[model samples]
Target: MGHLKDMVGANVAELVVVRHGETTWNATDRLQGQAESDLTEEGVKQAQAVASRLAKTAKHISAVYSSDLRRASETARIIADAIGCPNVTEMESLRERHLGNLQGLARAEAHLVEPEAFKASISSDPDESIPGGGESLNQLHLRSKHALENIARNHLGQRVVVISHGAVLRALYVHAKGCQPAGRVRNTSINVFRISASNDWSLSLWGDVNHLQGTNLLRASQRGDEMR
Candidate 1:
């Protein structure tokens, strides 16, 4: 709910978290969940643009990590290559929230099939889970916390880039800000956070896509289900 900068000591690690670029599912307004989707052509260009921006702004990034999902991994690879980071460690914990029966469904279809379940899936309750074996918002928050803490501990005082999904990042953002995001996270948007030596987290930036300006790559969709 509060900025970590106000709560942490000087010893801190900087984390640059990025949402993956657009995919076919993103363009089609479908839920992707843990299912895989390749980056669209525009998505590739977006990744390149973000990589260029990060290369100039975060040249000191010590490591790159990404969700194992194709979209996230592909984005991470581009950024890693541009920054000369050489490797991108894939972490399953960074993947988007498992959508269960909602995976691959169109937004309209999901809501029509089970309006209550669809509503709960998009609610802010940390314990709310998608029906049919999906992870809860609380589960997502915990995994994000663990993944970030592990990175901070292992790469103390360093800057690292983490490529993840919108839903996952949204959960982390909620954990940091103690509220739901004001809007959807754009493709290749960067969020900056700091983890103190005591493991406190603070958000420095959120949903930043300054590099995408004039690129016309940002989507206008408000479908929450598309974030998976």
Candidate 2:
């Protein structure tokens, strides 16, 4: 595999993409879409575990990029420290899908925050933006693809880690797989992919949580809020 990639030279880039560590919102079944949430104690431990996992890979990471959101920036910093990177790049394009007025509310209370939008979001059309400031699924797909392509293009031959949110990660997976949905992504789970010069993405791994085996926090629900 190493030689095969070398054959492509700088035309290919290796990416290690991960969802941010679990947050208070994640723990409470609240919607975190584009909202702020501190990482819980367990979340910090999860980040440490993933950091340790990346430290053992022996790959020279060129950079660490994450969403501007606190949860993701925090996770990226943890990973960057373990990998000896001194800085993290924050990008809003990598943010979770905007959940509009429903953000920060528990699933049970989401309807009350934005009744119509919440109901419409359940089965919104690809182009139909969720009411109350939310983006459409199509918008997310395009943003995910463009954000990843930009990252791969900028890094070229380097290997880098990108920490983002569940919704953004899921959008990437869906876009790469022709919009086919994958399983739920757990906090701190590792995902790997390679991007060709043509901007095509080949997934090498998805939602691997082996590093969290002993943490007893590997499982993540597939519910809508959890996905966000």
Candidate 3:
């Protein structure tokens, strides 16, 4: 793919992790864990920005993977087109954390309505499950871990891009950086990591949203250099 020509080699696979472009729910601050939503006009532009920037990585990405969710799928399509990748592969393993009962609730509403429950659910031990049919943080960690390992093993030396939901990325980052999973990930943020030749993974950058530096699409909720 055009976005990955510079990343193929015999040493390690450079992994480019990007959150999907914005959706209506995203703008509304709606919780969309495992919920399917389409990209908004702003999201299309955001994905284009990512493609414009990543097209320069020159890493020969051997493969492209995206969550089956519509927003992620659409965002992946834009990147694939920019990089000339023949296809975008859909992988269910990359879906967002199942928020279950919290699926459609607004963030503020959830917090104000159930502060204690929300706090408990997002504590240090992500294993705590949410109300309704949501999955425990542990489950999220396990699925994402399995998916990442599989990708590393199957495409050891090839660079790849994964378009996933915010929660899925958070789980991955928490595991990679040994941090607590809470808060939000910026829209269209790019995180870079690599599967080393020694069979270890290292995160190079987290939540880089520089591509939106001069764009008018910066979310109203974001401030300064942060993509909140």
Candidate 4:
């Protein structure tokens, strides 16, 4: 889709979104939920790659925001350095879906271990609660929309960089495009969107991983039924 490109100030304010780099839990094929975790060695490198690239292409990124998770925060910090911004402010509302009791289980393990409950959770409607306990799709919808609106209100006329989890970023895309929330969000990939003076949003790209280039970009959940 063509993204909106009008400038509100002397320049247009684009939302440059990057998924947080990978993590030790990710390497172990574990569900990180909203639990805090550190970036893997490769994840750090991936963030650096993104930061390096942004340093070259993106200009006038006046503010940075990130999920409160350590992985996302750390990645945002790297990008901030590249852009010469001080640090990213943490936004808890931008955090990933709270996976509840499935915090550390592999998708396969969770399914086999609690097949009925797992199925119920995944298939839960927007209003229904996830069986094992967690944020429902509807809850995420509310929080993400609120966070973006707040950002747009406060940072009206400047490019902003946001470092967030894969699923959370995907949720933003789905919300902006009015699509069913099933799109893939590659780790450390970038998605671009823009907001207008009238407060409309446009999705420029989604789940892109060109920066990862030659690395194996697979997620443990992708090997399960999560792939679309």
The candidate maximizing lDDT is 1
- Candidate 3 — which residues are off by over 4 angstroms? 1-11, 111-120, 181-184, 220-228
Stretches of model 1 off by over 4 angstroms after superposition = 1-10, 123-125, 220-228
Q: List candidate 2 segments past 4 Å from native.
A: 1-9, 219-228
What's the TM-score of each model vs. the native? 0.90, 0.91, 0.85, 0.86
Model 2 RMSD in Å is 2.8
State model 2's lDDT. 0.79
Kindly list the per-residue Cα lDDT of model 3 for residues 1-228, writing each as its tens digit.
223345355777777889888888877767777777778898899899888788775456667899898988999999988888989989999988777666677776876776655665566666787777677879988999778777777777687888887777777787677874445677778887777666576787778777877777666214111112
Tens-place lDDT per residue, model 1, 84-169, is 99999999999888877788888769888867668778786868888877888788889988888888888776788999988878
Q: What local distance difference test score does each model get?
A: 0.81, 0.79, 0.74, 0.72
Q: Report the Cα lDDT for residue 182, model 3.
A: 49
Q: Which tens-of-lDDT digit does each residue in 8-55 have in candidate 4?
A: 463334778888877877777667778777888777888887888777
Between 2 and 3, whose lDDT is larger?
2
TM-score: model 2 vs. ground truth = 0.91
Order by TM-score, highest first: 2, 1, 4, 3
The candidate that wins on TM-score is 2
Off by over 4 Å in 4: 1-12, 181-183, 215-228
Supply every candidate's count of residue pairs whose N, Cα or C atoms clash at under 3 angstroms: 1, 0, 13, 0
- The residue-level lDDT of candidate 1 at 134 comes to 80
